[model samples]
Target: MTVEYWRAKIWGLLHDPVLKALHNNSGRGKNSFYKQLEVMKPWVETGKTPDQSGGKVLENILLADYIASASDRSAIGSVTASINYAPGKNREKGLEITHLLSGARQEWKINSHDELIKGKRKDYLVQKEQKELLAKVPKELQDPSIKDDIKKIKQLYWWLWRCLPQATCDLFKDNSLMLMPAETRIPDASIWSHVSMTSALAGALAGYDLTAAQIQRWQGNDELSHPYLAVFSFSPVQELIKSSRKMRDFWAGSWLLHYLSAKVCWQLANQY
Candidate 1:
């Protein structure tokens, strides 16, 4: 087989898992967004004005983006909650799986958070998630079938661990990789987290039937204050590491905490 063919295959193996997890978790309204973008494509490509229906589509897109972009940290006080709310008299509730390989746990020294963060802690052993999410790669890349293309295979390892994570962090503004700052000015939370939270917030705001003036007033002035947003935080790092004997133990505890917290966030996001 050609060297390029093998390179492409390896790339697919690494890329597909992340895409699957993201789609499974955050795919609601994705089709609608794609359709709306398609409708605006012609007008976007040509500098032509849209018709009435097209104009309305553009308006909704702009409104959603504006509401999505606003942040509570700024004086604007964010309208993300308003976007999540839709007019619905009856409420529906159910359980759903939001991600692939979510049920699988990492095979390592520690199993639970208590073991990781408390008691005689062990070194952080690097591990991957379920084989389903992160498929095993060949241990040796120097196979005779691809001896001529060994360089590319070696490069794939660097790309998988370094380049791919950096790209995702840059694109989605997710700093989970912690390779570099996702945002320069306000390097706080992940954009995906913000997107999910705002979606939930919008759903809450939809029921109020607030007037444009009221929303504008809330955005413009800080006087009309009601708890429109809630901030939840996790702390106690020192306590979590009280029993750590080595650097690896602290690292293991932190990773376990982050992994568990992410699972909780995924469930909460799916609930809304």
Candidate 2:
């Protein structure tokens, strides 16, 4: 499929069944639901125009699934229920299950050690493990990408780290027995990081080996101590890494081949 195909598919997935279900279920925060719809309405009414809302529309669209999943009973009840249920069959899966958007951006790079610490939610990380983990991130990841979009990708990684604690807490909270909130909405930090990281991870999975290399080092402990590593140890990552050669092949043949390969090639081809 072309990038346009995946883009439209993702949009339709969010705007149709997801949003439609939200409209009927006030239990899932009618305000948040409508807010998402409002952000998406321009595109829904028009077509695949530019992200004129400066990512706000995409943000709202993605959050809609999380909002829907927060409901115990609602218009989009069964659909959300199924989508939300997949993660944590084993805790080792970490927070990767929370990735809501498919075909997300996937440029993963850890730059400044200090910035990386901040992104990991310094307040939540074990001081010593944090230092070691940061130290171990391969020096290679810091090499500037030959591509033009490294700035944007770096910003995404930064935001993902920024959003880690809150989003991690929200997605994995033990709310199984608690009553569903009248409106289930995460803070803006979670929303921003969620979309940003999804893209970053997507980039990493598509052969940005540095991301996987970093993930391996971060997941060094069985405790899943590192915040981002713990939450991001989901199935897609495992599948993405398994049979690395084959995965790379599939990646090249897939639509991301068109989307990500061109970008990667641009960077590598220009590296001199």
- Best of the candidates, TM-score: 1
* Regions of candidate 1 where Cα sits further than 4 Å from its true position: 1-200, 207-235
Positional deviation of residue 254's Cα in model 1 after best superposition, in angstroms: 0.8
- Estimate candidate 2's alpha-carbon lDDT, on a 0 to 1 scale: 0.29
lDDT of 1 by residue, 18-69 (tens): 3222211122222111111222233324432211223322222223333544
lDDT of 2 by residue, 1-272 (tens): 12222232223222222111111232222211111222223343543222222232233334434443343223443445321111225312211211233424221121222332233322223232233323332333333341123443343334334543333234324222111112222211223233333333323222222222222232433221111232212235446545457766666545443556577657753761
The per-prediction CA RMSD against the true structure, in angstroms, equals: 22.8, 19.8
Ten-residue region with minimum lDDT total, candidate 2: 15-24
lDDT of 1: 0.33
- Alpha-carbon local distance difference test for all models: 0.33, 0.29
